[model samples]
Target: MSIWWSLHLRREAASVPLARRLLLGTMETAGVDPDVSYDLSVALGEACANAVEHGGGASRGGSSEAYRVTAYLDGEKCRIEVADSGPGFARAHAPRPPRVDAEHGRGLFLIRELADHVHIGDKPGRGGTVVSFDKMLKWTKDPSLLTA
Candidate 1:
């Protein structure tokens, strides 16, 4: 079975967990492995944090800012995308890993490390920036439930 969902959220820190919980519930109900679900949830949080912190343009202002997050699961693979309505970044430039001691700038790096594929781009019609990533899902048997 395939499952998918999309959330249009207010650009606020609190909104990030709402998205993460929904993804976790969906994955659990769909029989996804616990570890895989946890990793994706963390990555999702980072993406949403970036959207809430850096999405949209200055003219748009905080009062009306919003972001969109989508997740799709089809058997052994899952894909997630987070898009914002803020001023977009330069399409040709990729996010560079920050210095090891830097306090911030590690979100994208973590997402890239966890996800099998990552794509950063402009949202449709100059809307804003989009961070899309996918992971190969893996399933592990519950040890207590396994009888040799």
Candidate 2:
């Protein structure tokens, strides 16, 4: 059996901390590796930031939007999905190759680089995008559970 949790977060930068807390708490209880948790946190943070930035319409005064985040964890992997309300990203827009001096776009880029698998889904119902990514985890066993 796999463990899965989903959260609906407002489309605001302030929600980043909330998202982090949820991710940390979920992964920690699952016995995920420390390094993997850190990486996934960073990746999930970036994905959330992008959702807020783009969902807010940046300078277009669109503040009625929201986003959703879902995380699934199994014995060997942790997968997360970030969704937004409107102005979602296109599915085919692959993350650009890293550059030494570029400074404009790179949120999804980092998510792709760090996650073992990444999936971008079209907005459901209305308009928005859901970017999903997963990271592999090292397997560990607890003797207590076997004896329980």
Candidate 3:
């Protein structure tokens, strides 16, 4: 069996934890390995935090003050995507690594570290940022859902 969910969340600091908790709970209920669940949850939190902090622009004129998070658990892999209505990345420039002492720019880097695959790019047609990642899941000895 496969499980998936999507949330349209307000871009508030409080919303970050809500999304994290939901992901954690879903992974737990599905009997995903605790360590794997934790790593993905942390990555999810970072993406959500970025959305809250940089996912909007007043100059965009009535851009929605919300973002979207979508998660899919299929077979032995899980994928998560977070998208926001902010100024999209420049077509000519890719994300660069932050300096060692930099506090801010580490979220995307950290997400890449935790997940098996990561994609960061502009939303198609609409102007926004999208960060999506996938991880190979490890299941507990006893799982609530049957493995494929």
Candidate 4:
């Protein structure tokens, strides 16, 4: 079975957990392994938080008041994408690892560590960042719903 959903959320702190909860609930209902679900939820939260923080400013060319989160569960794999409307990654380089003593700049790195594959880039024909990641799903011993 396959499932997908998308949310256009305000760029606010509260929206982070709301997106995380929905992803968690969906994974739980689909009988995903709890550990896997937790990892994905954490990654989702980080992505959402990043969008809320860096997703808005002087509009480069897109909507500045909201961002988007999309999730896809297909067979043995699950993918998630978080997109925002802010100045794109004009830095022209990958995110550098944060310092151990630093309090920030770890979100992208955390997502890369948790997910099997990650893509961070500018949205096509737009001024924003798009962070996409996917992981191999693990099912519970006895799946209650969708199973691979």
Candidate 5:
């Protein structure tokens, strides 16, 4: 079958590396600028991390399985999906992290903030689910020069 975006596998942290590589290849091949690649990569990485940490990978005692991360690029828009093999997550029950912490429970928020569209089931039924993000190729053209 013609796979538009489908990455199926076990659940593990190391899988994220391959996922990133695949994304880089896809973006590069799609003629996406390096800047766009970087920004998209950031969003992509965060998604993969979430899949591993909050998906099924995190629940595994020490299983070396891998999750699925598939992304599709359509002209100025790119669609990314991350799915793992595990029970569904509670999008409604995820306790919103306190504001004091700058790094907790912010993945979904960041994903939504960066991408044009986001779909988070955080579960894939029997094999878990796939969270998706759609973004453009111009979001990373100019990096901040005031990074001190």
Candidate 6:
């Protein structure tokens, strides 16, 4: 079976963990290995945090600013995308290694390391950012019907 969900959340600190938890629950229910789930959850947290922090600077007057998180689980692969409607940075400027004592600037790096594939791009005309990633799912108990 394939599972998918999308959440349109306010650009706030609380939204980050909410997205992560929802992912965790879905993974757990799907019998994904704990270690794999943990890795993906951390990566999701980083992406969501980035969205909350830098994805909502271009809101028009009176419009409620928000970000979107979408996740898809199909067979042995899971794909996730987080998008925000804010002025975003360019992908050509790759994430740099931060100083050892730095308090921040590690989100994209973590996402790239944890996920099997990561892509960053502009969200079309609105000039927002989108962080999309996918990981090969490992299940402790494989379901016989899932061929892919």
Instruction: Output the TM-score of candidate 6.
Output: 0.89
Candidate that beats the other on TM-score, 1 or 4, i.e. the better one: 4
Q: Candidate 2 residues 14-58, lDDT tens each? A: 999899888877666666666788889999999899888876543
Error of 4 at 64 (Å): 0.7
User: What would the per-residue lDDT of candidate 3 be over residues 1-148, giving only the tens digit for each residue?
Assistant: 5999999999999999999999998998899999999999999999999999989855354555989999999989999999998888676866689999998989989999999999999887667899999999998987665553
TM-scores for candidates 1 onward, in order: 0.86, 0.80, 0.90, 0.92, 0.71, 0.89
Of 4 and 6, the candidate ranking higher by lDDT: 4
- The parts of candidate 1 lying over 4 Å away from their true place are 58-64, 91-93, 140-148
Expressed as tens digits, the lDDT of each residue in 1-148 for candidate 4 is 7989999999989999999999998998898999999999999999999999988857744479899999999999999999998787666676689999989999989998999999988887657899999999998876766444
Model 6 off-target regions past 4 Å? 61-64, 142-148
What TM-score does candidate 1 reach?
0.86
Error of 3 at 71 (Å): 0.4
lDDT of every predicted structure (CA atoms): 0.85, 0.76, 0.91, 0.90, 0.66, 0.87
RMSD of 5: 7.4
For model 5 the TM-score comes to: 0.71
Mind sharing the TM-score for model 4? 0.92
Q: Which 10-residue window of candidate 2 scores lowest in summed lDDT?
A: 139-148
**Candidate number that wins on lDDT, 5 or 6:** 6
Model 2 lDDT on a 0 to 1 scale:
0.76
Model 5 Cα lDDT, one tens digit per residue, 15-114: 6677778777666655566776766777887888876775653355433256767777665677888776556666768646447667667777777777
- State the lDDT of candidate 6 residue by residue for 1-148, as single tens digits: 6999999998889988899999998888888888999999999999999888888784675223788999999988999999988778776776689788889998988898999999998888767888999999998676433433
- Order of quality (lDDT): 3, 4, 6, 1, 2, 5
Pairs in clash, predicted candidate 3? none
